[model samples]
Each structure stands twice: as C-alpha cells, then as structure tokens.
Target: MSASVTPGEPGIFERMFPIRERGSTVRTEVLGGVATFLTMSYILVVNPAILSQAGLPFGAVVVATALAAAVATAAMGLLSTYPFALASGLGINAVVAFDIILGRQVPWEVGMACVVIEGLIAVALVLAGLREAVVRAVPTSMKLAIGVGIGLFICFVGLRDGGIVVNNPATGVGLGDLTAGPPLIALAGIFVATAMTVRGIRGSILAGIATSTVLGLVFGVLDGPDAVADWPGSDQFSTIGDALDPDNLADALTWALVPVIFALFMTDFFDTIGTAVSLGRAGKLDDAQGELPEMRRVLLVDSGAAVLGGAAGASSVTTYVESGAGVSEGARTGLASLVTAGLFLLAIPFVPLITVIGQSVPYVGDTTVVPAIAPALVMVGFLMTRLVQAIDWGDVQDAVPAFLIIAGIPLTFSIAAGIGLGVLGHVVAMTAAGRARQVHPIMWVLVPMFLAFFAEDWLSVNVF
Candidate 1:
C-alpha cells in the first residue's frame, strides 16, 4: 500500500512525475520498472528472430524493437500519466511474418504499410469514439475465439519453426524427427521455461532462452555472429522506413490483403484495449462508467506507437499486460514506464548479444528452421490460452463460432481468414437458432465484406 504525501510540497522530480501524489517513491517506481523490464526483455531476442524470417535484418530489428518499445512506453507514461508500458505485440508479429509476408507472399514493406493503415484507422476510431462501438459490435463469442485461434496459430508457428512438426503430403501436418537436435533443443527450452514458471522464478522466459542458447552451443548447433559485440554497422533500421514508400504499398496491396489489414488492426485493437482495461481495473483506475482516466491520450499514444513501430520495421506496438507486474510492485504512475524506457535504451550496447539466436538451421529435406525462438512462441501461446476457459462452452451458438476461430486459424494459416470464418459461423448459427435479430448489425455488414474477401482470390483466379 502507498502512503499519502502532502499535495503542494514537491520534492526533486516530484513536481514533474507527481510520484508522491500517486503514492509511489522514486526508488519504488525504479524497482517496479526494473521488474517490468525483466518480464518483457525476452522480446528483445524473440521478435527480431521471428521478423527476420520475413526477410528482415535481425540486428537492425533488435534496435528498432527496443527503440520503438522504449519510445512508445515512455509516451504512454507521459501522455496518460499511467504506468502502462507499450511494446511490439507477439501474436500480431506472427501474423505479419507468417500469414502476410511469408504465407501470403506479400512484401514485408507492404505488410508494414498495412500496419500504418491500421494505426491511421485506429487514430480515426479513437478521435471519433468509435473504438468502443466496434468493440461492442464484435460478439463476445468471436472476441473470445480470436484469442484462442491466435494462440493455436502461434503454437503451430513454433512447432514448424523448430521443425518439431512437418508438412505431411499424405495428410496435413506431421510430427518431425524427435531425434533431431533442433527440435530437442526447442523442447528442452520449453521445459526449462515451464519449470522456472512452476518454481516462481522471475524472468523465467528469458532464463529459458539463455539456457537453450547455451545448450545449443554445447551441442554444436548454435553459432555466434562473426563479431560477438560491436558498434552498429547496418541499414536494418531503414527496413521499415523503406516499406513506407507509396510504391511499396501499391505493390503489396491486392484484393487478398484487404482482410489482412483488418485482421492486423483487429488484433492490435483488442490487445491494447484488453491490456489497458484489465490492467486499469486491477490498478483501480476505472471510473463509474468503467472507462480509464485520460483514455483519449492513452488511445492516441497507443495508435501513434503502432505507426511508429511500423515505420521502425517492427510489429504493431500495444500496451503490455506485463505492466501489471510493475503495478503490483508499487508503480503508481508513469515514472515506472520512464524507468523502463531508459533500460531499453541502455540495452543498445548488447544488440549483437541478442542476435545470437536469430539464426536458423537447415535440415531434413532442406527445411529452414528457427529452433531457438520456438520455445518463446510456444510459451506465448500458453499464456494466450488462459482466456479460453472464460468462454461459454455449453451454448452451441457461441461454441460454433468459437470453434471455427480456434480450428480455422492454424488450419488455414491465416488470421484474417479465421476471423472471417468465425464471423460467418456466428451469424449463420444465430440465424439457424432463430436469434438472427440479436446479432449486431455491423456483423451483417461484415457478411458481405467477408464473402468478398474470401471470393476475391477465387474470382481472380477463375474469372476475368
């Protein structure tokens, strides 16, 4: 519990941050920020590794990821006067790297353009107060299903990345060589993270990655960068900026990508909102209407951060639920986030140290596999699965759409498609149950969009 300090008696740094008024000390806020950073530092390694698969430069991605997150998080604190930290989100990165850039074969630049579009759209929605409407318009079932579907999708990515699973021409996907060194390493990392979690270790995920990297070195599967640590020497930072060229967006945009943009927006939209709402509620920051204070500034910062992240050649940035860790440790204001931002800036000296695991190995049938980061992806999936138990399984109407989303994501390997199919499923199931009138009108509007989104490619392939 935080003790109250006199209102007008400002100490050094107190007038600006008002840490004392918020019931926190500089020391307490500093400790809280450190705690939050430890919890999320795994992203410094995992994100670039994943995004690199989409043909991005891993080292530059390291700098972009840290710098983007630091700036956004610091803005979140200064703008909202809240302790929330922001970062490039996990699932959205998978969708960008796997679904759009690789699976859909869209250029990474164009994929980034879509992220910029998502940010612009978000800014419009926030300014117009339409975000809340959209959130309500999405049926509860579809909302829950989105999380579950994405969880499965991320898990599948991890499995394939580490080559623990393989494409089976006879069926769909199959188990890979359990005897393979890469898969074994991934499996061991997963077990290590799981064990540390069970043991209540702080920074368990980061520890797991470190342990796996060391084990990989021991088994002669992991190789260090030609130069272990050195001054910056690449154009990776320009990767995202190069994507913003209008020609790049034009080249990337096709009928198939309309839904991809919407999907990217949707994931970032809900993730930020959910993180803010849940963390705010826990922190006692909600009003009688259940809205957080200074929400407008928060939304602006969130949307702007997404745009900045896109330009930085990273994933969509959003408020981190990990901020809760800091809040729990006595972070009552933005000082904690400021502290975290500084730490991120301080990590710049070790960017090469973080890139060691971004490299993948080619093996059985010449498959390229990113073994090191696979464990982190799988662990993220596990964290996402917590929301599934909140869904109402007894109601078939809800169950149908939820199941479609959960099953369709990994099966189709497309986040946009899974969401579209889930919407269709929900609408159709409700109509069959004589509850069509209960469906949101926005959903009806989406029916045509979803149909067109699905049909565009087929129509293009088969018709004029």
Candidate 2:
C-alpha cells in the first residue's frame, strides 16, 4: 500500500514535500524544480564527455554516473532534510580530468579509487564534528567572499563551456567566431534563456535550452538520428574492473590515487562547508539560535555521494548552491529536491535525448542566449547586493581581504587556496593593526600551516 499523510500532521513525505507556504505557490514549486534541474542537467553531458575523454565507455560512464547522482541526491533529500542537491562538481572535474588523469597519465580506475578515498575522509570529518568547527573558523567576510568568488568562477565556467569565451593568444580572452558552429547556436540559446528569466518567467532556463536545441536542429547545427544510432550503451561493467586493474595498481596508488585523494579532500572539504554556510544564510535555514544545524548530515551526504559516485564511475560529488536560486524562489523543504531528483532519474533513459537536444540547438550568433545571460546577470545582482551589504566601504582593511579572496580563486585555480590565503591575509592584517586579540586563537595554528604548505610547494618547484 502507498504511504498516507495524516490530516494536519504531515508525514515524513508530506513534511519533505510540503505544500506552498507564504510567497510560494504550487506554481512556484514547479518553476523552482525546473530551474534546479536545468542548471544541473549539464552533468548529464559533461560527466560523460570527461569520462569518455579519460577512455571510459561513454554510455556506461553516463548511465552509472547519472544513477549514482540520482541515488546520492535522493539520499540528501530523504536523509539530510535540506533542499541542497548533489552532482559531479564543476572545478573538480577539470582538476580530475586535466590535472590528475591527463596531466599525470594515471589510469582512470585509480582516479575513481582516489575519489572513493576522499569521500571516506569527508565522511569521517563530518562524523567527527570537525565540519562545523572548520566552518566557524572562517571569517564572515572571507565566507561571503568565497560565495561570490565561487559564483564568479561558476559563471566563467558556464561561459567557457557554452563557448561564449574563446581564447585568443593575440588579444587574450575574446568571443569565438559566431560562424564557428554549435557555439553560435548555444550562444543564441543563452540570450533567450536570460530574457525569459529576467522577466521572472517560469522555466526560463528550460525554455532557453529547448529553444537553442530546436534552433540547432533546424539549422543542422546538431545531429539527428545518426548521433543516437552511434550513441554508446551501458554494457561495459568490466570497465569498472579495468579502472581498478591490478596491473596498473602501483601507478594508481602513488600518483593518481594519493594526489587526487588529497586534492578532492581539501577542495571539496572547503567548498561544501563554505557553500553550506552561505546557502544556509541565504535560505534562512539556520536554527532557533541562528546557527546552522544538521550540517553534519549535509557534509556526510555530500561525502557519501562522492564515494558512491566514484564506485559508479564519476568524479567528485559536491552540493550545488545554484539550487539556492530555487530556494530563493521559495523551496522550503526537501520536496523540491525530490522532485528534481525524479526528473534526473527519468532522464537516464533519454541519453539520446540529451545528445539530440545538444545537437538541435542553433548557435546564438552575436546575440547572447538566455542561459548564458542569466549567470552574468545573476553575478551583477550579487555584486550589487554585496556592495550595499558592505560593513565598511571606506576601510581598506576590510576591503583588502575581501579583494584577495575574490581574486585568488581563478588566479590560483584553486578555491581552497584562495580561501586559505584570504584567511591568512585577514589574520595578518588584524595582528599588524594590534587587533590580534580580536582574532581567534586557532587562526595562529591554521595560518602558519597554510603559509608553510605554500612555501613547501614553492620550494619544491623552484629548488627541486
């Protein structure tokens, strides 16, 4: 028998998928779900693309990764009771595919193993109560800066992915030639998506994606039945064994497994923690005491998802704060996420659906499409709010740390390093101004360690 809800005493499912409260109607929930899903749908394509580049069978990789994400995300909604969703992280994928796999030529199986180990570390940290302590240790300004910095970084990623930003050695970053093909159609779709979203239209992102996809089809920018006919299927479970091959065990153990494990641990550790705190503040998910509760649950689920993702043949898993955009639109409980998860679960059978859609879209040409537009516009929105929220606009002391953190992420291509440097900078500035007592004592230990680590990296590069 199906579960039932008691009158006025919402059952677990009811509580999870609560009906609309003030300022949020049934329509709002539906719209929020679409936004959340579209924003995350990139994983369906990107994950397969990356894993395929790493020499995994495209079909098996896509199916397994999607299934893992579905399970992990459903667990987050059911277990954590937060609206947050999980997927293969953006920057970490670049690090995995580029820095670890391709750069070091580590076997893909070993790469998966590293992801598994990192997940274990994350789980242990959350269980040990260190997640909260570590988050609290970060300065408020630093936290806010991290949020904005990540947003900017994500925007940059979207731009690059959509082909809005093309490299030109002669003139640095410039627009790609619109005549170049799929990128043009993708660009067009971005503007349309942006226009719909700006007017507060429901499913603006979805509309934009659909519109671009259709244009691509009409213009021959995308493939038709041939792409589907050639598409891979999920028949290669043995690849998982190859990924864990004993023959490649030693190289995997030393380079691929070890470095990636450390990289994922440190990177996702800070990324998830910072995102939770920031999104908690944004969604007002704090408890009666205004502290974030159930945080361990969020971290545990995120970390657990990584392990599951690795085993299932994907990269690292982390929470997407873009889901907060849905929350800002009024998603109070986990139901929104459950609904989002349901859609992803359905999309698995439609892998050809994604490839077809990707192919059918028309290039945006000179006009930017909606999806591309939304993030840039959202970045503007965040910047304006941040400027108004600044505690002391005139003080260089406050401005310096914020600037360093914001600029450091893309500059170093490491969010953790950016935050670490920002924290150390803040502590130093405070201490030099005779405000050392105002700083937390833990700062003394952490700042020195951060400096020492970076110093070691520099020494290794320069001297060795």
Best by lDDT: 1
Error of 1 at 124 (Å): 0.5
> What lDDT, from 0 to 1, does candidate 2 have?
0.63
Clashing pairs in 1: none
Error of 1 at 145 (Å): 1.1
* Tens-place lDDT digits, model 1, residues 1-464: 99887776676657668687677888888888998998888888888888988988888889888899999999988878888888888888888898889977877888777787788889899999898889998877778788888988888888888789999999889999989888888888888988988887767677768777877888987887676666665664566486579887676566677778888888888888888888888877788999887888888899988888887888788888888889889887898999999998888668767777767887678788878888788888888877899889999989989889888888998898899999899999989999999999988988888898888778888984
lDDT (Cα atoms) of all candidates against the true structure: 0.84, 0.63
**Please, what are the lDDT tens digits per residue for candidate 2 over residues 122-148?**
888778877656556656666566655
What stretches of model 2 exceed 4 Å from their correct place?
Answer: 1-39, 46-61, 81-84, 98-114, 225-232, 235-286, 291-293, 322-339, 356-395, 412-424, 427-431, 434-464
What is the Cα-based lDDT of residue 113 in candidate 2?
67
**Number of clashing pairs per prediction, in order:** 0, 29
- Show the lowest summed lDDT stretch of 10 residues, model 1: 231-240
Off by more than 4 A, model 1? 1-9, 251-253, 288-290, 462-464
Number of clashing residue pairs, candidate 1: 0
